[model samples]
Target: MTSGSDGRRPVLTGLGAVSCLGAGVGPYWNALLAGGAAPREVDLPHLNMRATRMYRVPGAAVPEHPRRHAGVPLGAVPRMAVAAALEALDDAGIAGPDRADVAVVMGSEMGNASVQEERRGAGGAGRPRWTPLAVAGAAVGTAIGSRRGNIGVGNACSAGGYALGIASDLIRSGEASVVLVGAADGVTRVGMGGFDRLGAADPQRCRPFARDRAGTMFGDGAAMVVLESTTHARRRGARAYAELAGVAWSCDARHPTAPDPDAAQLVRAMREALADAGLRPDQVGCVLPHATGTALNDAVESRALRQVFGPGTDRLPLFALKAMIGHTSAAAGIFACLTAALVVSRARIPANAPLEQDPDCAVWLPLEGPLRLERPAVLANTCAFGGNNSSFALTGPGGTT
Candidate 1:
């Protein structure tokens, strides 16, 4: 999975995350390895719902950024994005003149929805706190001084992966040498109410692929990754955590909220993504699935996995992060991507949280403890509303098969 002669391949140089586990990437990774849970009662009194549990970042765990946005009143999502973006840039050692060519691409399902709700609650008497462009991408671009461009994607839960794919395209097309890409989402009254109305909110913790799994619990968090062209990375002497081997997306277009039970589109996305990487299913060390814990979602995803990996699917390790961090919506895809990056870097798969394996989910889930990877490549999957599905391949710095 080396870059072409022109160094167009995108390599992951740095990662930053503000998850329910904590603010820094170290804490998030540690919590995943420890199989910790951070569930708390949802406090939104405005939303009427039976499912009230959610995974929230502690108030103290929120990173402070005094210089971000200066006098502009920043929303929680943008603030989290700025914090994560700053950490990513610092982690990548990308500063001075290198910052000028960077592009900022972020995704969010509910961009400043909380701010909008607040303004609406106030009867719009005061100055509005949010704008159409008050998304994570704008805030990150402002904070990082990215002159190339700022783009925001609102592709539901799959937006994060879409952001990464878009950034890679930008680099490959020579539109930008570097791109800061990821996603962020904060809880909002509208978001919670909508899920509750749809009966998709889990009353307890998220337990993906578990027998009694009811639904997904919402989580607040953000994740950012620094992507640079191999040529630029080499010229700047930057160390890479992983390479973005390949990414592909597809839409089922069968239903607006529920995925097609047949999973035909998802299978195509996975196969096309593998083809793009020029790798076989057996070459992948593990899979990070978008297991939302819902009965239909888990089952559909399992069928898709079986279709793509065949009998080998039963033996391939499946790492379900939503069980640990809850589903972060727009941030979910990149969070999984970051976890994959860590998995390849460490060569170990974090254990899926405790759960009674669902007979319906035919994939192998490592619940006992960490499972060591035999190879450095990982396939990360993400699916969203509107029947959108995305799959991407990531390889460690050592390269892929």
Candidate 2:
């Protein structure tokens, strides 16, 4: 998809990730192509939950320098965000004054929950007060030396997708030429306990689209991307991986934590995102679905993809990323988009995690091996608590400049 007449469509020029697979975009993509990492027992103190296993990032991969930012003590979540954001800026070849005016937008549901949890766990005496929940964006802004703005998106699991969309708007509207978009989260005691109480967490592993799928598993990490206007990238001679051609958001508001069984809003979001990108359903090569391993969510997304793609749904390759990295909550959307961008640039779709297909979820998911991405564009879906849904499209590098 070409940028609109204004040639201001957002292009993805750099990607950085910290995940269970490892740090950096290279390890993330390489591990995805190699069947992805498995979940392991995580050490979440005060988390009295049966579902303790998660796709936790390695200790060595997380950076520990810059322990404090703007007087706010940094925790794992903000530290991961800073690491990923700096990597993205470096990957994009953005430095010095060039980074000064770049805006910082981050989506985080639990923000610095680990910091708060630590304070509470330690009786909150003698130690400084805990950082705010929106500290990740500020942390990123300071790390990148950006004074333009620090915006936060709190749309639960779909926050990352919303952050990307907002960054695109910033560039297209001439508000900024370059924007840093990212998301990060660490395990939170309340989040885990609430999921356990609601019976919405899988104890063994996340098995989306499986006949006996239990519930989604939580993963912690950060992913960052550098989005720039097409003209800006060309001026700097930066190579783009993909064009963020379309972004659409919708709300179901049907339930606080459950998706609407009918999936009306989700289907609409997918269709509208394609329309926004000026793409036909047949042009999309693959999909990164928000199949959270929950029985209802997977089934609903399966039906929703069918509604949007119709007959093409049968042949489309669906990459169930959560099965590999577990659900990153607010970071899931950015993770999916990063995966989609890689799929578009590399022309290959990674294999989905192994599972026994559920007849109720009829969408196609190629688990045999890596498949060639034949089409030009890739689409991704992200839905969150309160039925907030987001869908976006990325086209091959050739579709950009």
Candidate 3:
């Protein structure tokens, strides 16, 4: 007999997503495995980002379905969040039309890129600021609410993954037995232009950790998970994707865009994560790298990764979501985390399209294949421009994994 969800450690029971690849975790996973689409050209209306080659979820549809109260607005960040959250709720069985014992933890990196644009426009005209949608639009917690879980975190690019980590904590604290954690971001002209100005965006595409990589291509999407303790889960006869084992975060406080090259803080965070999980660096089956494909980030992360995991850290399986879906800012962290989970569920990771092994990345790159997992445990890493670094660990339940 299986132990009740509450009796067992907290684990992710369900997942939902709306990414540049597509809506729904199933579609995105299929596309990712099929190598259906890589980033491409697009126009961001908010910043009037014209003639820009960016990553986008092709044929993305936010249908005005009756199920979601007329559905979310197509192509909008909030819309994506709402859609993804509802789907996550449904997947988690939290949608038994019950709103109790559930809370929402939502995080976004580009939160309401349009609001800033409007604010900038109004400021130029000396106009007073007041728009209900402006703040609400970007607020992930506001975008979607759950019966018991609602937490918002913005740790730069680590926003979403951090949200999941904190939600796991909330469960550990019994704040909410079930937490709906969400991460979302928008690809507005303002957002993309800001990165472009920072020289963090490629005019064409994203090639994470690639030696010839230029910069990340901006993409927009949402990713979320429903986490619950084992006792509650079994009481409700729920299934679980994996148990959330550990998470760690740190800040270099170095530069706004450039990371602490040595990544001392970053390495410590990863080590702490492994320690929290009671696992060794060598036990790490795979590492979901935060390779932005930029010279500095890749170099810094590579250095830190090698230092922590050492010689064979490169032997660890590596899969960069940005290479296929582009970077979703706040969404990147959790999306990558979900990718880790997906790898567990699928027991394989898709190839990195549009990305080739670089002389530098070769030391840390993993082989692409009919991905297989022996233990179903994974480590996901993220770093932000403001020196934010974090790592989280999770594993499949039942030892059946």
Candidate 4:
């Protein structure tokens, strides 16, 4: 499986993420691998997301910040992105985002929650007229730029993961030498209500791979990584987090809200990724699943994993991040990928919270706790409501400082 990029592989140079676990990369990473729980509930402004406990980033985590482009107010999307991207930039040891070798791909499910609220209510005082500034700020791409390079990407819950795939493709296509890829989504009234209506919102909490797990809780978060051609990164003496090995995408071609449980196409997607990486199924160490806590989704994932990874699906350590971070929706895939890479880089897996192993889900889920490994390859999986299935095969770097 040769990389499409002039045969040059792309490597992960930096990573940053914001979650209910913590604010910046350090805090977020610390909390994620700690295996602890917080007294958290659905925390959103000007919204009623009750009967659910979620992972909310502290207000301090998203402190007031200036917009990337002056005039734009640094709102939730930007706040989340800046925290993650800045950390990545800092890690990459590059000041200023004006490098021609860089490219940006930012993904979001729901744009700015605050802005959407304003637009929906703009009806206030009179038939609300759309504000140009408001509309621009709400654009997902504008909220994320490298000052160096820019490309905005969005596709429902698979946004971030797909954006990462796009970034890898850009590099593989020889369009860019280095790329910054990220994903962000926040808890808002619209998002909460939508899921609540779908009967997928767990009012109490999020429990992934749990025997009694109900559903997912909406969460707000952003995750970013600096990816560069392996040659470029190695030449610069940068610390590599993991190899952005392979990525693949497919549509259920089945249904809008339901996954193709038979997994014919979904399994193909995983096989494609494995082929792209020139790796075999047995080489994979863990599985980073998009277990949304829905009965249908969880079961579909289980069936697919078994088909691809064999009965070992039960033995594979399935790191269920949503159990702790809730579902970041569009940012979910990328966030899970980042966490998986961190596991390889840090040599320690992040534990799932509120995870109760069910006879079904437990057989294939690493529900008990985190697992440690030195350098390992993992598959990060995500599925969108429209039968969109995406997967990224990643191998963690050798070491972490």
lDDT of each: 0.85, 0.89, 0.70, 0.71
- Of 2 and 3, the candidate ranking higher by lDDT: 2
Model 4 per-residue lDDT tens digits across residues 255-317: 878787687778888988888776688778778888888877887787788888887665677
What's the CA RMSD of model 4 in angstroms?
3.4
lDDT of 2 by residue, 1-401 (tens): 54464468788998989999998999999999898988888776666778888888999998895688788777888899999999898999999989998999999988887776777777746664655788889888877779897899999999999998899889988898899998998888888788888899999999999998999998899999999988899889998989899899999978999999999999999998898888889899999999999989999999999999999899999999999999999999999988888888888999998889999999998987789998869999999999999999999654631
The regions of model 4 sitting more than 4 angstroms off are: 4-7, 36-39, 43-53, 67-74, 97-100, 118-149, 367-369, 396-401
The per-residue C-alpha lDDT of model 3 at residue 208 equals: 74
- The model with the greater lDDT, 1 or 3, is 1
Instruction: Give one clash count per candidate, in the order shown.
Output: 0, 0, 24, 5
**Candidate 1 residue pairs that clash:** none
Residue 288 in candidate 4, Cα distance off native in Å: 0.5
lDDT of 3: 0.70
- Tell how far residue 183 is off in model 3, in angstroms: 0.9
* TM-score (C-alpha, index-matched) for candidate 1: 0.95
lDDT of 3 at 2: 25
Per-model TM-score, in order, reads 0.95, 0.97, 0.87, 0.89
Residue 185 lDDT, candidate 1, scale 0-100 = 92
User: What lDDT tens digits, residue by residue, belong to model 3 across residues 1-401?
Assistant: 12223354677788888887778989888888776456666643345443377677655454332212222223366667777777877787875445455777777655655544544555556643433322212333444443453556777688876787788778777667787777777756666777777777777677777767887786777787877777778888888877777788888987887889788998998888777666677667777888877777887787888898888775676777777788788888878777887787667767666456676755445435546665566888888878888888766664333
* TM-score-superior candidate, 1 or 2: 2
Name the TM-score of candidate 3: 0.87
